[model samples]
Target: MANGTGVAGASAATASEGAFLEVAGLGVTFGGLTALSGFGLNLEQGRLLGIIGPNGAGKTTLFNLLTGLVRPTTGSVVLEGRDITGAKPHVLADAGVARTFQNIRNIRGLSVIDNVKVALGLHESPSLLSTIFFTPAYRSGQFRTEQKARTLLQLLNLDDVRNLPGDGLPYGAQRRLEIACALALEPKLLLLDEPAAGMNPTETIELMELIKRVHREFGLTIMLIEHNVHFIMNTCERIQVLNYGQLIADGEPSYIRKHPAVIEAYLGAGAHDA
Candidate 1:
């Protein structure tokens, strides 16, 4: 559904107009092999976008590039009009970017609430002197942080297990916990990489609803990478298809579903009716 001329013209317009998250001519290579090439995107604020491709389509690589886990070989990443290319992960976090991994990465021994608290602490920690002296200010801050963590837990439906160890939670709840922790950062842009990777059908459906709720309640711009075509087609307002590090389609679900290249590359020939 995406033609080179249209995409290029859109990229040019978005660059000058200042998109919320703008990427242009993004490319990455490891050694001599190209992992991603000529990637460009312009994500407006408060939109839920999905990226889908087969394995090794550079989905994770794109996330890595955006989060500053990897540097691009060419191009720029701009967030809210500020160039963030090559920014460190912590710097990106401070700049209001947050993400969850394909695999859950909760703190193994930390309480579920504590995991969220830790992320909040990064942005709202008390002064060292106050903490060392156990000052009333520090105590008050801790209480406030705990309350905030509890609210996030409740939002993710993990309040009942707030005291339980993060890694000790069931797989589905652990995934939710990871999302809660990311939300604890109060990010403006949230990137979810295969949040439903191992979820059962019911869990996947629930996760889809939760994602929609979060987007609505928090008014956050989100980008998701997933292999589940059905989930992406249902949840995302706009979708992009990639193959061998190249984008083949970009449009609404109906358009992407019917795109010849998308069907051939990832959705298969039978997906014409999808």
Candidate 2:
């Protein structure tokens, strides 16, 4: 077990060759409880990585740390050679990081398009005075924003229900809509937490293809936390396993599937029985 201290002395280092994102000696504690400890990994540009663990394994906590939802008790987060540890969420967003939550988060009252617009609005820098007077610049900016939003919706295959309320869509579409909203941030790194949580086998398979398409089309470096072993095994290029807030294994899917520590600690004894 990692105890609360996590991996020790995982310090920020010179960017590794092709290292787009890196975290070293990352640990977090809530009072006496240890959420994560000694957690560290490197993500290359344009690679899709998956994190898997049993419940209470501090998976969501890691996502929170990456997106600036909470600060870590120890360690550093580096993105493209910049030390972004403890940066605020908005600051991280500005720095090209975006994420979708484990639960669907969207403006249920707002149309699907408007949900995306909210994300775009966060990074807009139009002068308030121009908007007060309805200046051409503001109008033009809004027009361009809408056009880009539409393009993103189309890319994610959500354009058909662009006018529907986000909450009105079926569970899977709502998940896709959330991803579209994240895309509006124009992120270089996108974190998806449990994207296939409620989908059936067919939907999950479809989502797997969609994820691959998104990664190829956008040229993004993506990381996801998913509970579905089959989904992660099939989708991600590399896999990291977590148990008791510690990284028990990290490797390609084939290696991960057979790692003894992973099977004993999290994957369970019967994992290979079938």
Candidate 3:
């Protein structure tokens, strides 16, 4: 996992294959308290990055800041070399970033295909007027987009239930469907918040493989926040550990597992190198 997801060494910029996203000096505050401080990260394209830490470490809060679900009091979010700090959620989506919630939030009543279509239409639609008329060009565009959606569904092994309501699919399938919805946006960067949450061990393993395949097959740059330390270590190339709203460690998993500060602050004294 470290081999696949590791951050490029210092001099990441000059290393060629530069970072797709660079988060620098990110800090978040609520009321009088700080939720994240001096936190930063560099994400290379087509890699998987794991964000992990003990509870209240601000791992999810940092993700919130990245996705613009919550604004950081101070910091800048750079995507594909563009400043996007404080950008609205929809703006970020339009800027080639897509994310999924840890909790299941896909449209429960929509058929699986329609759910994916809704997200795809945002990017592929030629015009609102065209869609309203169902003109040849409009219908033709929608057909191609739907075909892409169906192909993605099949690639995710979800076609067997393509016509099923989102809520009717099994839990594991629903999670994959949520990822499919994110993919429908044709995003360059994907943020997955605990895609394996609430899954059995078998399902978790499969999900990890699916994530890797997404990176390999689609060459997506991914940032993920996961509670399962072992799984994250096994799936992410490099990881960032947060503690009490501060960055405690950032490096390849092997280095982090042995970092004394990370052990004491985020992983606890009992955690060891994988």
Candidate 4:
């Protein structure tokens, strides 16, 4: 339990202790159905963690709860030791949390660079009065925002297609474009939901490296939900397996790959021996 595996019962007093992100006793119920239960985690800064599970295991549900799309019925979420249990999505974005979706959400008609610019505009827009007159300060801010957006585009290797429509890119590039938009937010904690869901082996490998490079360059704390077991095993430092919305195993990739509970949930009884 050194990795805080069964810490769903962790006391509130210790919830904020030395963790960049912490969740204790987190759960959600939709009507009479429990989507997640007693899920807890403590993620240190600059760490990469993966969440894996069979279908309907509540992996995406957890991301929604963390990103303010869904309010939890129980527990608290602490980031940098501040409680943010039920904050709104925009509030969470301002507090340094950003996420990509399972489906590509690029704006259809916007150019690739403009897609990222939209996120930058959220925080970098000049005053309304300055905007009306196109003041020097407004012009300066616009220049800075465009520069930053281009940097993000280059980071994701989409600069070559900067002028193309967001929805016109190939499937893999579209996924990366979504990531570029998320990066424009300058987030501290980045949640990636199935970044490799629709890729061939080659594309998945490329995305895996891209994610690692981003993590290294930005010093970001990343938590991803991925179904590609090979990608998760290689990219993440730690893995948490969920079964029926509950944590069945939490540890290094090697341990999680061989855990009994994980084997049973993912492959059925005795499948590990087969």
TM-score of each: 0.93, 0.92, 0.89, 0.95
Instruction: Mark the regions of model 3 whose C-alpha exceeds 4 Å error after superposition.
Output: 1-18, 266-274
- Separate clash counts for every candidate: 0, 3, 3, 0
lDDT of 3 by residue, 156-229 (tens): 89988999998788899999999999998889999998999999999999999999989888888898889898
Estimate, for each residue in 69-164, the C-alpha lDDT of model 1 and write its tens digit.
999988888899889998999999989999999988999879999999989987788888999999998998999998899899988899999999
Residue 29, candidate 3: Cα error in Å is: 1.0
Error of 3 at 185 (Å): 1.4
Backbone clashes in model 3: 3
| Candidate 1: clashing pairs of residues | none
Task: State the displacement of the C-alpha of residue 4, model 3, in Å, after optimal TM-score superposition.
Answer: 19
Evaluated with lDDT, which candidate comes out highest?
4
Q: So what's the TM-score on candidate 2?
A: 0.92
Q: Whole-model Cα lDDT per candidate? A: 0.88, 0.87, 0.82, 0.90
- lDDT for model 1 comes to 0.88
In terms of TM-score, which candidate is strongest?
4
Superposed on all Cα atoms, the candidates' RMSDs to the truth, in angstroms, are 2.6, 3.5, 3.9, 1.7
Question: Scored by Cα lDDT, where does model 4 land?
Answer: 0.90
